[model samples]
Target: MTTTKPRPTGSSGSADDADATYEHHLTADEQKWIDKKKYAWIFSIVPAAIPLIIWGVAEWMKAIDAPVFFAHASWFLGPIAVFILIPIGDFVLGRDGENAPEEFVPQLEETKYYRIVSYLYFPVMLASLILCCWQWKYGGMEWYDKLGLAWSMGMTSGIGIVAAHELGHKKTGFERWLAKIVLAVPAYGHFYVEHNKGHHVKVATPEDPVSSRMGENAYTYLLRSIPRQIPRAWNVEKTRLARSKKGQFNLDNDVWNAWLITIVLWVALVIGFGIGILPYMVIQAVIGIALLEFVNYLEHYGLLRQKLEDGRYERCSPEHSWNSDNLTTNIFLYQLQRHSDHHANPTRRYQSLRSDVFAPELPAGYATMIAAAAMPPVWFAIMDRRLMQYYNYDIERANLHPSKAAKLRKKWNRVAAKQQQTVKAG
Candidate 1:
């Protein structure tokens, strides 16, 4: 058997040699090159805030009675640009595919800039929601325009989940509180409870509602995940409270705190904007939550960790989730597509998460894939084949939903027969 080599401590080796020995994967030269790069680009990620600005612009354009194209089209800007243009841009601009050097890793992780960005998202998200409400209550517009305002605002609200996701993973009191504040916008505070304690524990298995199985369409998955998530979150929080000897409805139950926040916000908005604002609030919450679940579907579609004889599943690895390193998309999403690394090390800060070469790659950014998932046929055509490839064409190895297994088996047989015919003809 091969023995593992000892890693050098900072003192044991020459400066160059120490750098080489420290990283498990990178070469000495690669380490040196990456360490020399400046951390300034981390600040450039601020431009990812543009969608919030665009939402404001969309509302302002309508308020001013701008040209029909400018006014009507403004609502579509966030969705179209994020889903369509950014994916095309990823194709054209391509990926850098660089992971920071181990020597510089500590520096990157220790920086306050990353935390500041997460904090900053809270205000921007709050501002977007306020703007939407103000326009709905005061600004005169058609019902369709109001709907457009909700839809545009909903896109940003969905992104608040991202902020909440990052902050939810933190252990600090302030970060956790910040997560609840952002989550209240979409009325999805339960995610903070479920995602951390529930999804992370059962991801990639049939037990996980958040993890989509083969042949389950996005709509079906959303229908399942959204309802299941709340109960799962409640159970998780209930269990925690029991272990700690705390009451479930008490402030110690973080879910209860977040739920209270959500309810208060909803009541305040309803009181201020009248019963008419109720539908807008509901619609935006549904859209935001649906967008999040759709993302959950894309992240771990058809992947599974094998259950052991003892009943525990195999430890999560990089291969369990799909990854993408599209430069612009990664920046926009706060490197969330470095999902493999995130699952493998849940507490790692988003800025410090690295792309693992072994993880299965997504063909496009999550935004683009989510757009495609809206059409069942297009989603199946793209993802089914990738699922097949991931499992080496073995249907049995894929985590297929029970109801859809027979249908998937028939489809697999047809594809196999077609391939056989091609071979025989050749």
Candidate 2:
């Protein structure tokens, strides 16, 4: 809804130059808007409290010792809420296509309300995680139920990391340290190192492991991305310390600090709650990291930036990311689905992120799509067609793994042949 002219190809000039030129083209008249909407921004903080809500319900269920239905399935209450209810709610409530007026963008971005919510996100998340750990040790649930509870805790905590992401992009040291603190919840401190330093530079290209290429399934992508990213983060941090003439082992190494914090958290939980808490913590952490990976898979799956004549990939643009403006999901996820804008202006606050019409649209909210991604056939059937259509059936335009290139080409040819045959029959 924030209408702007199409940007020139990334190869035409530097990315900063493109952004500056784009800003310069806007006229004074188009920048003014009388209406200011601040009430809706409050809903963005709801995700920070989801863990507490889930914990409250779980406690209630235990108090009642509810029937088998609630007792057995209560552990999965968070996932069911997010993946099932949220998607359904999105479809029912529908999307808001309005973008904040241009002049109002700065005012929204500068709000202390947004910053305060982000800052408080950490303590709430930390409290919920401790509560979950306590419940796991003493709740006397079956292994199945315990696993479910741990997973729910993990999933909700993973959303907390989304708050961490918003803070991590800030230029201030306080926000960045908060990012590192929140990341320790999932033992994913490396995310701070890799995502900003590594993924941003190479995203939507084959060089980035986090970016799922055409024909790659989510399962395969998860396995590849999670392992590779840790070392990638470490290496990135190592390089940074070297440039600063600092030792890799020092506090200046953020990766080391995050890892130390993670180790301390785990050790404290184990000492406080006994060895049983260890599995719960580890499983929950794994699930939390997996949730992040699942999102990474969906955000840029099968999209690619073009290579220039000099072999450097074109700078990323809105077209390189799949976006959803689905209102309910966007509110819960902190406008993460407006990912095109986030990548284009990495430091922009979530409340001010605009939906770009030029970005490729997702069929549904991320929660619905994440569920679909679990079924590889369904994911392929939906996304593969979208990918082919986006590239006009030209495989060269797609970022495909070499092993799948020939098979995808053959598949494309078959689709083309079917279309031709249908035309002849007509």
Candidate 3:
């Protein structure tokens, strides 16, 4: 079991109080390490290395008339490497101030290494797409192999999701454009507009479909979020165009064009590779979408802000978002586990993201959480209690009600019933 040491609460004279309670219950040394920019280089290396190796293997496989298994697998590797592995690795491997005697709070403001790492995302995405096409043409990969390729592409697109998330927070036009381009890779360009314009503005409130209400299961969230997000994306773009006095057909702001690009790309693949490639692409897309939803589930799982008497939700703070300080997963996924910081200060670079020791820590990294989400009863039994403890067992304050609780109970029971039925059938 992962143990997070609690820090002292309250403000101090220091810029970042090592003694202050963090959302994740980090120690003083962990706080100091997070404040420093020393590990930025490490982020750059892993993302770059994974794609370089994948592309090289893909080319070699093509030459040898072998199936591009690893190349296809590389797609999933990138997301797993970035989102699941990195943060978890960091939490487990990172040195706390207590363990490392040399640790000190650095005076440095930012690291150039982080900026370089941010730039690496573009090339990595491009290389993954190119390798997918190469494998399709030369390697003559089979259907299963193509499915792997699709999954890899989906994984590559998941990185694009990370990039979209990062750039969406920036104020500059260049940063925003980079973010849109990243979103385009996933054919999720609308996410750039919707997430910034809609989700963030309406987050943790009923208006935001992506925000999971207390007692909602992952399966329910997937059903609701996916369909809602697509229309929300369209509505957001339509609203933007309306404000600018432009029509939906206007190429400059048309979301349909972005989606068209995705369709055209798939059509080209089908034409070049045959009808089988279409299923491959669709499956790849599903994997990417699944990854996105899973992250969404992680972001605000079982957390809700209280509605004030004035009919407004409380201001989002570090406590509103779930945080994971796992060292490996943090570095790989670009500090996404430092979610509370991201919600509190959206524009801050991933390198500068800080964890709140006071916030609840996920029982495991996202990979494990995804698996756990599959078993609703077990997931609810485990996470429900943890959430209750985090919020001091006040279900009402956490926006949990008897009806929602009952629904969760029924969902879990159904899951058990189905499993029992499966066992009997087997």
Candidate 4:
């Protein structure tokens, strides 16, 4: 691993200061952990295990004609495990101690763990899809139950959403192909085109559907994002074809062709499972989209980049994204909360990602944030003040835009107005 010396935290001369602060380099023990590929494989298992086990147990319950309560309750367990328990474990149990040993930072260029994690994508996804098919076959679940499971299980973790995130950053043909396959499972294949081609380039700006604006609630964002993203994906693919002088129907390399493949898979599922299963498929897609939006809410909750004098947004840095060091959650989601580093270097594998202790931390893990987002006043109250403090530092070293500064002031004003209105009503 290439160890780039740590850069300073401030806007001006902090890079030099940051390098000076660190005297000791990586110890022998730290090097061993950094060098191994097995750690990635082991961590991948943490997220996949619970869902797979739930599917197996539910299947068994069906075989035995188990009581309805046991079988029905078991269905919700997998979603709870992924969204609730794992996030809580991450926030409460994963800690960086004061006495933790210093380690040499791994080289960012190495792709060791990235390769292994990418390969596991297919098997884990196939397993989840098979489980969904099984549930359709014998569980005799209603449309809503199957839909909920498909959305929460097959789409959220099965391969559609998470693996798409992994493949969206990769450059190789096989890596891109794998990403498309995962999207097919959720019938969200357009994400491969829009997310990779559009969102990354336009993130945090008005042009990106997935990027939430300041003061936008998650529910409001869902209303806009889902409808916007689908057509955006198609337009992006068409633009790419026009630029390359390729015919619109070019199947060999066109992203629309990939979407066609996803449609075929969707049709096959409907035909085999009866057209009644279509609603379940739609519900699962909705769930997957909900999970994705929730993740968007956390990625840059109250953050925005400044426009420079050159009429361009400042280049994204570690400071541009939120960071969380909750180890269990990091392990479970494949280091997703170590988001600052990922944005700084998009293609870096999760195993090699590091936490910037100087970066702002999320109050809780992603799951906690999801629950908190449901209550807007409470969530805004907790986060708004912290956002002000983050940007209100010494003028020579502040990391915020003028618009954001104005937004913060306006947010406080709105809070005061609401309080005054409450007092009058009371």
lDDT, candidate 1, 68-104, per-residue tens: 8787667556566656776886788788487775456
Candidate with top lDDT is 2
Residue pairs with clashing backbones, model 2: none
Worst 10 residues of 2 by lDDT: 5-14
Instruction: Give the clashing pairs for model 4.
Output: 1-107, 2-107, 8-14, 8-15, 26-104, 151-284
Q: Could you tell me every candidate's TM-score relative to the true structure?
A: 0.86, 0.89, 0.74, 0.80
* Candidate 3 per-residue lDDT over residues 304-407, each given as its tens digit: 76677999986665556777766655655677777876776677776666666656777766656766776777777778777766754455445443358766
Q: Which is the better candidate, 1 or 4, if ranked by lDDT? A: 1
Candidate 4 residues lying further than 4 Å off, grouped into runs, are 1-51, 59-67, 96-114, 142-148, 154-160, 252-254, 393-408, 411-426
User: 295-348, model 4: which lDDT tens digit per residue?
Assistant: 876677656656779989756656656767776666666677877777766776
**Cα shift from native, residue 379, model 4 (Å):** 1.9
In model 4, which range of ten residues has the least summed lDDT? 96-105
Q: Scored by CA lDDT, what does every candidate get?
A: 0.77, 0.81, 0.64, 0.64
2 against 3, candidate with superior TM-score: 2
Worst 10 residues of 1 by lDDT: 3-12
Pairs of residues at least 3 apart in sequence or in different chains that clash in candidate 1: none
TM-score, cand. 1: 0.86
